[model samples]
Target: MRRLKWVSIVAVGLLISLSGCKIVKNPDPDSAGQADANLTDEARMAALARDIWDTDVLPTVAEHLVPIDDLRVSLAQNEQAAGQSHGLRPEGEANPWNFAVSGSGSIVEANTTSRAAKLQVDTTGDGAADVTVQLGPVIRGTAIRDAMPFLIFTDFRDQIEFAKLAGGLNAMAHERLSLPEGDIIGRTVSFEGVFTYRDLASAPEVVPTALSFEAPE
Candidate 1:
């Protein structure tokens, strides 16, 4: 935990310093090639959001969620290339193929019962909140299995509770949750992250808009 805190501070300093430079963050991957006149640091942040979503978040999700029949998933744009590698030849060669890249990682869950639905989002890979996650709670019953559902964000402290969950290993795996307030306190959630080379390649699509900025209260 101490190490994570230091990392967050270093990242913040770097971001602040970069804000003064000429380069700005780009929002869309497609827009990356185009040259802009002069964009502010805020614009750069938006651009950063876009690139992060496409390159990091989106692909990660797609690789995990997208399904493949064989133990090995092959990613290809056409069947002829896929057929050359794998025994099976896809009927429609135009469509892309999915091949196994690596074994799956741990699963993490994110969920909320808070009505506000806001969370402290911390990016920059520091493993700490640049701002804070004020999202609602996904409460579990006081007892184990059998319990009544309740609102998670009924109080302000729920923010701290929510952060504990979001900052967990699940968020590292790029998984978020939507759950009843009662269940957030105790319950295991599933999550995964993946990286693939193609656009249609089954992987998580980065939502730059969601991850673009530090959540400020």
Candidate 2:
């Protein structure tokens, strides 16, 4: 009788332990749902630029596009306010205007070393350019990425990932949007792009998000 009672108690304990193991192996519905949500967030971040460009940028461009010449004037008039109102602040630092601009021009010169091609655009479409547009070969700075209202530092897992995302966007622009050295010379081009401003006299070196060109016939 004593032996039988001991055997029964051991069997019950073993069954309980096995059941606990199964529960751990197969998560509950709520846990599974949370995991799925996390994955979705990560996927959303992976396509951050495309997602924001469609949802946020296009609409903003339609509504708020400042002509390149007009923007330069504004920056000259009130550098601080222009930057604060139009530009996105860097993750932790404060700076002057980082803004978007749109214009059309002919490529006056191409500088491969600086990776910046110069465009002669007449904001008024007169005989002369109101401002010179600098197109990038190496698009640096955080102006464009930070300018998007939808993005926040916390949206990324860490600063490293955020930097990678920014660099990836730059690479995408270079690959898909930038014109070849031979193709850009003497060509007419139109662009919408972002720049960071430190002073009025400095030229706006733009990293174009949208660009279209017409080759000389």
Candidate 3:
């Protein structure tokens, strides 16, 4: 009887030990549902910006770009009409017309530190520049995303994330679109981009989504 009792106790202990050694699978090693949960705020914002730029902004801008000259003419004729025609107007703001513009020009000057450049473009191929195109300084602002008529505050979780998304897109533009400092000087360049008109009377500065250059042909 004593031997039988001892044997039974040993069998229970062995079973417990075996059970402890058994491999337990993690419920979320792939982290599918929890992927965003682990991301930092900046990382999440950047990811969202990249996704939106790829899926919404890029295609929309490409399809809807207005010629820089035409945009200028419209603004000159009537700023309010131009803003409403091609862009979404905030309830009461008069500046920052959200629109896309495209043109080719010679780089008159460049400021790489500021990430901006001035272009002298003659849209009609006239001898003189019809306009001085400001290439950027796109290092900040929610202008790009805000300019998209389809996108609104409700599209994002909050203003903070929305602001971060803009910053992310700006960073991406500087990374992917900007030219080397002196390389663009005197080079003929073509660009398609979005801009916010701070003042209709002043030259429009563009934040380029597509830019290319080569020796003038």
All predictions: root-mean-square deviation over Cα? Answer: 25.0, 5.4, 5.0
| Cα lDDT listed for each candidate | 0.32, 0.64, 0.69
Residue ranges of candidate 1 with Cα displaced over 4 Å: 1-38, 51-56, 60-179, 193-217
CA error at residue 61 for candidate 2, angstroms = 4.0
Candidate 2 shows a clash count of 2
* Candidate 2 local distance difference test against the native: 0.64
Candidate 1 on 81-147: residue-level lDDT in tens? 4435532212344533323122222112222435433332223234432222223232211110001
Q: What ranking of all candidate models by TM-score puts the best one first?
A: 3, 2, 1
Tens digit of per-residue lDDT, candidate 3, span 1-217: 9999999999999999998796887678568657878887778878877777878878888877888878878888997888777764333474466787888866655555555545665555555555454445455455577666665667778878777777777766655665554556667778887777777555556667888887554
**Best-performing candidate as measured by lDDT:** 3
Worst 10 residues of 3 by lDDT: 87-96
Model 2: per-residue Cα lDDT at residue 127 = 52
Question: How big is the positional error of residue 81 in model 1, measured in Å on the Cα after superposition?
Answer: 29
Better of 1 and 3 by TM-score: 3
- Report the candidate with higher lDDT, 1 versus 2: 2
Off by over 4 Å in 2: 1-13, 19-22, 26-46, 84-93, 111-138, 178-183
TM-score of 2: 0.66
